[model samples]
Target: MGPAISLLPALAIAFSASQSSAQTPAPYSPAKSGFDFPIYTNHPPGNTLPNDPVRRGATTPPLHPDETRKLIQVPPGFEVRVFASEPMVVNPVAMTWDERGRLWVLELYEYPRGAKPGEKPRDRIKILEDTDADGVADKVTVFADGFNLATGLALGNGGVYLGAAPNLYFLQDTNAPAGSGAGALQKANKQTVLLTGFGLEDRHELLNGFAWGPDGWLYMTHGVFTRSKVRDAHDPDGFGVQMDAALARFHPRTKKFEVFADGTSNPWGVDWNERGDAFVSACVIQHLFHMAPGGQYNRQGGTWANPFGYVGDLPTKGLPAVVDWRHYRAAHAGICIYQGDQFPPEWRGLVMLGNIHQNALNCDRLTPLGSTYRAEKESTLLGPAGEALRAKTGATIKQGEEWRHVGPGNFLVSGDPWFRPVSVQTGPDGALWVMDWCDRYPC
Candidate 1:
């Protein structure tokens, strides 16, 4: 095990192998093989890397968790901690809370580079429990494994829901071995394939953003790269419906699946408010949206056709986004509406979002505007009556400028690249838990 692997507890053995264990070796190039022939090196058009560092030299190594914690800067009253990292978990993309308050995480170990032909699936689903109430995960369990780029996770239906790109599986832990270590890795007692063909045109664009909607349906998101033909088992025709770039939901008991909102590039996060209104943080264009049933939003480079293929006014009827940041400088990872009470009353109801590229945490509030809703561009913490609350982070309306993400103020910014914040979840204790993807690559 390397330095990164040392962070894992002995029981967390799935990722104990070296990072290079299953990686493919780079191909041998004749140019670098002492063949000094006349090289035609001219500038290429469009997207091309000017300085390709292929075999030039090695880059910096992974940062130590302690070192990373130093570079993080949270809002004054808030503190950030490396709940878990490295060998214990790597590439922790998205996570969900189980009925028992256990955190189930989706580990896409094979990301940036999807599984190659003939390669075995190494991705896994891990359940982290802080039994000691130390605000840190003390027990790590391998709930499941053997997946290829598994990106989404949810807990319900008497088991765990896994997003394996084209297929969705419900696995119950009834048959799980009682102990940890190698004995814990057993097939689920009951396995149900709820749906299939969710599409994997691109690895990252697979079926994701799994959330149990306030309306009781299982909601998920798929990017434009995924051209899906999804169908439930109960469908008599045995033919799945075509779906792409939309917010969709499924009913386990009814055996029904439907698309609610359309025209999203790649929505990574989805959360529901007290009134059951849904909010999402998407990738690429349309960074923030207020989704409604049958609503349509436009995606650049899309056919401009309705995601549901509706006729009449549906094609031209697209809903505007709550917040269109105008720049693609940061890759937004996850967004969560603060439903926790541990934080100040003012922090409740504000939307907390994470920007992986920018290494920042964004906060904002949404207000109803006629038929649609609009976001408060300047992030703030409001009191019970929705008045600005003053705190060390300058929450006062006059000095609240420090909490703002837009305008002359800055959001919760971090100085280190390893501070990538991919998943943000409010814990049962009402504290915010962020998942970090600390590798050098964005994916």
Candidate 2:
């Protein structure tokens, strides 16, 4: 009588969320006079947070039905399902592929709702196309149309680098449709805001995540905007999330944005690990994907959590993001790392994530997802759309397998909270792709 903690399946728990509170609650919350303000860092610049960037703000893959991310365990080999759920094709937070394997995704139409913080978005920044890998997406165009809260997407140095929140753009494929084009996305167009005044949600700052670090440089993270309610100055909530949340490294040759690692509160997902070194994830759709390997980090060092009377020291903090704090809260979006081998290679470098709170998607190994950041591995069950909901629920566990487990990181664990596949990419074709901003709906 002591083995059944196995819950989740109450319809993937809260699934679609009733619809309309502007799509089921939480968005619109900006203007605390723009959340309060007090940022700007890099430390020695006279140590700052006195606010700057205006203060702010703000994925793909697809699959739904038959559950997702339930405390994962990946060891059996791999089969995971769903792969498609386009909730009308909009909120696709961040994804990239090009070079011909296709898969684009940036579509994040007006996503931050209620509870008041700095709300100001109407929509624009769509772009999707699956071209048959089946994770869903046959078309959902409009690559850039008045964006203000786009949040992460990269190809690197050569082009296609976006993150738009306070605006960061570059698209010249001019009208990329008819199969997502190539030759550098057939020369895209529009979208040109390289770096404007980021709104910084409330000192959670803004932008969230962005990556391109194979040494070519680009790494980023910004979130802590409640104007200046002061949430993360170094775990401002610690495992509770938000620690002054800010880490940067985008010297596209001195285009400058330095500020290498700060307190960071809303440090959402950013990646780099084939050795070029660099990994971050604190989007908090639930939390535990907080790795920090820009090389054992050190803005001067700081990590003594409980001394009460250190009088003045605090820089012993080198690689501390193992926050695996229990059952994620929607963990809003991602947690990618795995280097790839199509699975079962000892699961390779290991780390594949997307637990939009549940519906499932995780597969750890990055030293045990940073050492028991929960999901030591597995939570597959995502794909073939379960033969379109098993013809309508006759559910005999239909079809065969290839990567299936479906839910268990305590049900779509995100580290702590948030929902929907916020973003996931460990691609080069070794396989590990998720971005389901709505995969087309019904997850």
Candidate 3:
């Protein structure tokens, strides 16, 4: 009877095959799928959905420097000129001004994929200056080089604090002769790792958004997906704090590291309002959040790190987002509360955020709401003319099958589709300084 052959092997084979078939997803095809695929290159002129609001049409080819400037449309009495571009400063990711008013720009040349082991780092920090004060950067000096995926920079504590994943470094200019002040032009020959264990699982979600808090701590934003077990560089084997999707701070003098606030998806921007309330701009999930120390706010997804649960609650829900309304996409970066005098008086106290997917700068008015502030959509500060004008007129634009309200507009609008603004800061000259990634692929 064939030893009364057990049917176990046959049953197991059939079950495994069935499970595989169910688990494997089908390859994406535009013709077979209902989802709208992004068009990277410009479609033919006769295409019907040339500028489909949701899908977002193809990016225009790279425009000349002058032509790109011409495409930018600022409000009356304001002008958009080329501050520095290309050969002078390429792929500037983050910037911080020094005591001398020079712009220290972090050039992330090795983005998307950072430097591999044994490979020389391509990222660098350059100091751009308006020598003639003509509202243009005339001289560029290399401050430091040989950094891997450097995302943030801040000058303080007699040196520069740089956020390059897996390590936060303090760089000093050893070449500076006697008593050179902060931001002096000296070769950064001394490097010290203050803290380590920042995650690099995602290049864009590294330790970034460096800013000095009013409380004297060096603030930084650590994004979602990547888990961090930060420990002092001095204690490599000691117990470390585990965190992700959090606002972290470090004290250079004490060499202490702390996870200030928790929860958010890829928060790329952090800033404080006039009242010293901390606000953060995240991507994918909610656009803005008011973060407090030891606070566990809502994250895009995932369970909280506290196994015991927050505040003794079994199912801990996080705090709410400051912004009430939703934009077409929630990908926002670089938050700035307009404290500059270059814009009109009404612009004061308005929260300016970089709407990456929409290729514009969005403004929001903040009102005190208990401990946190409520953010209301103010206007599309910068975008395409047709879209901005339509928004101002309270019209609706066709998005897929539904027509959505165009919202409002007030500031600059660049007709160029490749005009991607990643970071916005009020310059020392009181003018708004925007860092344009200027690329077709935002990710």
Candidate 4:
């Protein structure tokens, strides 16, 4: 057992934002003719793209699990024990270890670096049971199936929320009684389709990443799948024409979703500091093009819409929203808010994030500077087994990258751009748990 602390006390104390209400949106005009398959400003499709290390090393060498042994990298001194290994289903997108200490892993259909199109789904909502209290998982069972690739999942408040393909779904995890066999996880109940209608263009930019922020409101991001179906155009607060909204915070009581932020590409993770402000993973837009440089999609700048800057305060119509979030190329996945009593006050409110494709995990300690509080990367905790990867890799990284297709305009040329996700959670044992493709944990 661990020390007890309030999860959303900040929402009640110091939480003063405008009131939000939910209403059924009326119909809107049809989409423009050119709206069939989306094309970025400049994408040169077809021809071959420059080769990337991972792409060229399509015959990549052996990836050792012990790559992070170098670099005095250690997180908060919390004793970490691998709760499970070879987590089975590709990259373990997100994980939630409930109050009862039950662990849930949302498996992404495709994994490793740069996920492509053909390998879209490999299925199963892997639920693990450690019944014996021995760190390792004693039982593994399918919690749910038939998913187009689930990216995030968490157990909070009273239910379990999953980052399903098109939207977020809430399932009642009344895992069977203690004596009940592994069969308990197999059956999923109290299924509620929390939100719907995320444009399922290719894979990458679907609306995903849901978690209860420190403020207590349900938060979700409306990834970058341009506007397939706009809910409300008459609504004055709408961003503009030709784009699906970006992010939003939902009020269960009111049953309405208010746009939290806009003008960004697909964002991977959403986490808030102890004070309740937000931070986005800001995933780039070109991953889908999956090609080399000089192609149409490969523009002069690197993934412009959301580069190195994590725009914050995502807001919708007067509500406090994501003001900004930093940008990282293919920064797909992993983020969480840690407020454990075990760590010193200095470490209490930090936001931790994981990157699947980048093969790294990072953290941004929240600090209050003068008038406002901002996030700064405290450490790049675990990076890809660089030296080892290089030692084993066949070729030296190629210099310049070129591509065949010139794209519809400028931004959609090379890479296939599939989505990558990293789910973060604070376990019952008072330790932070992160699951990527190869490893995860904290005791």
Best by TM-score: 3
User: How close is each model in CA RMSD to the real structure?
Assistant: 9.6, 20.8, 17.0, 15.8
Clash tally, candidates in order: 1, 160, 0, 67
Off by over 4 Å in 4: 1-46, 54-59, 62-80, 87-89, 110-122, 156-159, 172-186, 189-194, 226-245, 285-332, 342-345, 356-358, 369-371, 379-421, 438-443
1-443 per-residue lDDT for model 2 (tens digits): 11111111111211211111123323322111122223234468655443421121112322233223322323233333333333434345566666765555565444443123465543444444556554434555555555555666676444576765444565556565544434345435644545544454552235656776666777667654422122122223322222334565555555544445554345567665565445555543224434443222222233322223233433434344454343333343465666666554554555555554343555444443433233343334322333322544446443442223233332223211223455666555565555544321222
Q: What is the lDDT of residue 370 in candidate 2?
A: 30
lDDT of candidate model 4 versus the reference: 0.43
Better of 2 and 3 by lDDT: 3
Off by over 4 Å in 3: 1-57, 177-179, 308-316, 379-410
RMSD over all Cα atoms, model 2: 20.8
Q: State the TM-score for model 2.
A: 0.28
lDDT of 1 by residue, 126-245 (tens): 877667765456678887777887887887656677888667888776754443322233345566777887777676677887888877888988777678888874454767767787
- Give the candidates in order of TM-score, highest first: 3, 1, 4, 2
Per-residue alpha-carbon lDDT of candidate 3 for residues 300-401, written as tens digits (9 for 90 to 100): 766567644355332236777887576547767787887877666777888777765665666778888887888876654433334644544555456551
The residue pairs in collision within model 1 are 346-382
Q: How many backbone clashes does candidate 1 have?
A: 1
Given candidate 4, what's the lDDT at residue 97? Answer: 58
lDDT of 1 at 177: 42
lDDT at residue 246 of model 2 (Cα atoms)? 58
